[model samples]
Target: MPVEEHDPFEDQFASALRQAGGTFESHRLDLAARGETRGRKIRRRRAAIAGGVTGVALVGLGGALVLPGIQTDGGRRHSVAGSPSAPPTPAASPTRPSAMSADDVVRTLERLLPKGKFSGEEGRGTGEQLPPYARVVYDDGKGKAAVAVMVDRVRPGGSQALETTACPDKVFVPYDACTSGRLADGSTLMILQGYEYPDRRVDTKLWSAELVTPKGQHISVQEWNAPAEKGAPVSRSRPPLSPDQLKMLAGAAAWRSVADAIPADPRVPTAEPSRSQGVPGGSVSATLATLLPKGAEVVKKGVADPGFGYVVIDDGKGASMVQVNVQADMSGLANQLFGSGSRTLPDGTRVATHQGPGDKGGRGVVMWTVDTMRPDGRRVVISAFNSGTQHTPATREAPALTPKQMETIATSERWFSRD
Candidate 1:
């Protein structure tokens, strides 16, 4: 019998060697045991196979699974999946930087800021709202400092809304404490004025700067700062707003800007609705007329479906039609999608199911979903339905379609004339 050689990494290679059978090559053993742990390696292989399956499905279905504008419970308001529905905007050019590194931005800001005998220290870069360009946060120790700065690229002109500090009880409608302005740079900056109640003292003033850098990129610097002493008089003194109340005001302003950016109609390039008709349609009436079962009350109306449109007619029993997206904002539709329980439609003919986050109906690459059922309880999933859980500025690529494309999507399927 030949003596067996002992390898230093034998234990690590043992499982793989056993699976490889009596004769194994040294290279094979090394390949299995090197770089990644055993479990990770297995998972990687599985993921690859899953990816291949997904690719096949996409090709077969003509990319319906990956539509743009899908909503999610997470901060994102739109789907990242490449869909033909919406194209992204062109990347704005990078602007000239005030400083190359975080340290530099901090140094420049410190030099520009007012100095005193206050205690404070500088901080590191969190991330660039834009790539390569970095954002640095600083604490002035006296509760005064610049929250962030954009050293490069400035976006061009647009009107921005500024709001005063007033927490509203009902957040659905617009609150009255804000104002909007168009900046000289064509980029609008909103200045939100703050005031103290009773005393009518100004608590702090905040503002956002939208600038179009020489290179055509857009950048906004948001900052706020409080008074020098407790109960001190607060006032708005100059341009480029102070960095006192940035943390409190940043969230609402950022998302509001994004909502403002979405066009009334995102589809164009074909025979759909004209530029004017695409604006968000009126609120969906939850009345009996619109809520009738697919074919019962009426038959043969066309509805918009994924990638194309289709028609359905109503039969007496219920309705015979493929479900399309119901046009209600994320709020009205969310409960129907993932509400705590189920509810019957206005017609009393259809009952729909609801599930929570991470549930089967709520899973997707870019957004969560909520599954609905027809009157008979058949499953139909509505993807990307979120009701204001959190928000981030929405970004778009080049326009996806023209007027012609929109018409094609809406009228592709026509229902037969009813008797």
Candidate 2:
């Protein structure tokens, strides 16, 4: 299960800001899709964050502040660091400051605001090759707000700089209040006040403040009540700074010389990649309750496998979830993951199927799948959902199983006798 080769946009913002391991082993089928155009795009454009580093290069690396001739609804402008693959100008050695000048980080963030009155500023200065931000729109009289800062880097002593301080992954982000710490010079700060839907459906709060720097920079400072962070509409109920002013604007030491002049992914890997193994969540819910199919009824279950799992059945006509995955050996990954409307079996086994239309938000819901494999690579996938959750909504209207009972439970042999 240490299956390698993956960087779907660094698993889309490392699974939209990861952190969860009180125990539940782990799970990741495209890390439960959070990107590929905002999760569950039904699997095609092959999430690699859409190739060659875009989203203006993860907004220079840690994302969330974003604002530099912004365009994207398919327009394109995003520039903030002289990019042409910016990254070859390093020679200084003294205690920092060879370059990076977003107007001295917008005058040290409008001279460390708090007496507030700031307004409409934009940022990006590290002599351009992009990755350093600072936005403004404060109002202190209480209403108009949105303050930003992004500066990036993180891989020094990696583990993504200790999970960028921690607290995310409430099964895919939905926050309310958070805090984290460490810093006597070792650096690590946190302070979340989440909601941009992890299933609040959308109350749109989004407060943030993450630090991390043991040399792998990653300062972030999100704010949102609406001025941006997705087609604005909330206006203001929270987000004017407080969580100790977002931990003093993410521990600002002037964003450590613009994260020491950002640049550190010269193709990363001084270490940090080897965690991915699955199957233990009660043996993946006892091998998906042995392929149920008689008046169903299972209630809710979860076990995002050593490979993946799920249940949530009901059969009396409402709730339906049914999910599963297995993946062993994988014959050098079947010609780039099954294509040309796959189909092979004559005992060689290959198959593929789909019914589709449930991309994460699950509106009217409906999905039914069956993907098999086995020339000696043993794979088996399955799906079904009229929904009991993929956030919510949709109680029925197809999918309690059937696509030939999900292709006989994805070509079963008891999922190859539980490996």
Local error of candidate 1 at residue 164 (angstroms): 16
For model 2, the stretches where C-alpha displacement exceeds 4 angstroms are 1-37, 40-89, 92-139, 143-146, 151-195, 206-222, 226-235, 238-261, 268-380, 386-389, 393-399, 402-404, 407-409, 412-419
CA deviation > 4 Å runs, candidate 1: 1-99, 116-146, 150-177, 194-216, 224-419
TM-score of 1: 0.30
Q: Against the unseen true structure, what C-alpha lDDT does each candidate score?
A: 0.25, 0.56
Error at 244, model 2, angstroms: 28
Query: What is candidate 2's local distance difference test score?
Result: 0.56
* TM, every model: 0.30, 0.33
The Cα error of candidate 2 at residue 22, in Å, is 27
Cα lDDT tens digits for candidate 2, 1-419: 11111222233233122211112112233222122121221011112112112231122111222212222222222342354444565654576566665556666777877787775666655544445566666777767766666666666666556656666433224456787878788888877787555445457676777787777677777676766544467778987888897787778777877778654434444556553333433354467777787889888665333455667788798987776666565555565456678788788888767676654443666666667778887666776767675555578888788777776776767665635
State in Å the error of residue 309, model 2. Answer: 17
Cα lDDT for residue 74, candidate 2: 26
